[model samples]
Target: MPPANGAWAWLAPGNSWGWSNAGLISDGEESLLVDTLYDLELTDEMLAKMRDAEPLANNIDTLVNTHANGDHCHGNELVCGAEIIASSASAAEMAELPPEAMAAIVAMAPDMGEMGRYFLDCFGQFKFEGITFTPPTKTFEGELHLQVGDKPVELIEVGPAHTRGDILVHSPKDRVVYTGDILFIEGTPIIWEGPVNNWTEACRRIEAMDVDHIVPGHGPITDKHGVAAVRQYLEFVHEQARQRYDAGMSAFDAAKDIELAEYSAWSDPERIAVNVDSLYREFRGEQAASDVFELFARMAALAGYDVATP
Candidate 1:
């Protein structure tokens, strides 16, 4: 059975990633949506499904942007008159990234711009339009409890790891936790902002939770084991990156040098660069903000092309 609380999850696949999905949730009265997909068409389908599941989007009172990633919140503008909510950190990070940037990135195709086109085609599959920039109607620190009709949900802050404002949504009564990007179930876990250890710890915390159902920000619905696998990946990558960084290896060299043979089967093998980049910054302390561009460049090397930038 799908999640109750009037929620619906659609598995959106193909394009760049082999598997990617989006979700919707409602609470009878005012619905709360989590992680809208890339564009209006996809988002419209998700909304229609949500309405089919429960009549909420027609009058959604609140919306939450788990984090600022495009796949998660690109279709936000479609939720007309809905009060948007995200951690201050998430809002800030998202504001810095305009949908135009993504549109621009995806504008390229193979050949003169093969890599850029690949990224654009993959990440660009989700249509983004009419998405006006609306900051969160409400922001909170630590934890926030919300009532969507009678459903009680917890908005948790577990970031400075995935992104500055990464959050997980927990519904204790429902025994479900929507782990934004904290857990990527069967997909490549990337750390745009990380202390890899913090991410490792977040996984531990997830594992320790009373909840049994987990909805990863990406990939299919999963369980604690799925959570554990992601945790293990981060731990392994952290150790691996640290080894190369200590040897004074550049982030690119580390991406190439580290084989990750143990995780050879993992999807998006290129994300090793993201893990390396995040770990490198952690190793550098306050003086560093990982160069996301450089990391993307290295990632593209391993991935065969740059799919995120145009």
Candidate 2:
């Protein structure tokens, strides 16, 4: 659903794993797209809807990827002739896990045991095959200001939190902010990258903005109240994880032991496994990246699936 004014939001149905939201900000013949969908088919459908609702969408002049996540950018190939944009960190991260890698993972799912089944459960619906990874043609750091005809659009970099380079698309004229994966309204946010403080600060920054509609990367369209909820979740998780870390608990055990309280209702509680692992690494001052497979295996365990015999 779209806000009463300003930009229009295109949300995918449920608040599950790969279902993300996109946006369109248009002024006369010029238009800017917030993000794309999970795959070619999904993106094409979104584009068709946008074109029907706003004629300017047929000629989208700018395509701004809020982050490097595959769900937010895998459909870039459908938006032809648009100047694709992303943060420099996001562009680099995009290369780290391309479409081919995802396809390969899906193919190998059958033999990988419980973690494989969990991966399929999260992403099996999306068609990742034959996706030509379309990287951003233009990249920036900090902030970049652009325009959609007469409307002023601001791209604010608030990352090294969710990912290496996450961004928020603020359209001042329209009073809307398209937060990439920064605000996963009502969904449990996983920390692929974190200082935890940075993510909380990003939430505060959004609250301070003069915007009415807040378009999240996943889940429903919301406002500052929704932003506050996500912030509260982050703060709560950080505090809980910190306490467990101080007690010399392993990250996996800490995730299991920590009470979610009110946030237990959120989708994908298994994500707490990843969040605790990240916090534990932070506490240890470990700069090494966690293995993606290992993280998924932990999440699978948390989800009550038996780990494959080694």
- Best candidate according to lDDT: 2
List TM-scores for all candidates, in order. 0.89, 0.98
lDDT of 2 by residue, 76-141 (tens): 999999999999999999999999899999999988877789999999999999999999999999
**lDDT string, candidate 1, 21-118, tens digits:** 65556665677777677766777777887676666668777778788777777777778788788888888888787777766555543343545554
lDDT of each: 0.73, 0.91
- C-alpha root-mean-square deviation, each candidate: 3.0, 1.3
Candidate 1 accuracy as TM-score: 0.89
Candidate 1 error regions (>4 Å):
14-20, 108-112, 286-291, 305-310
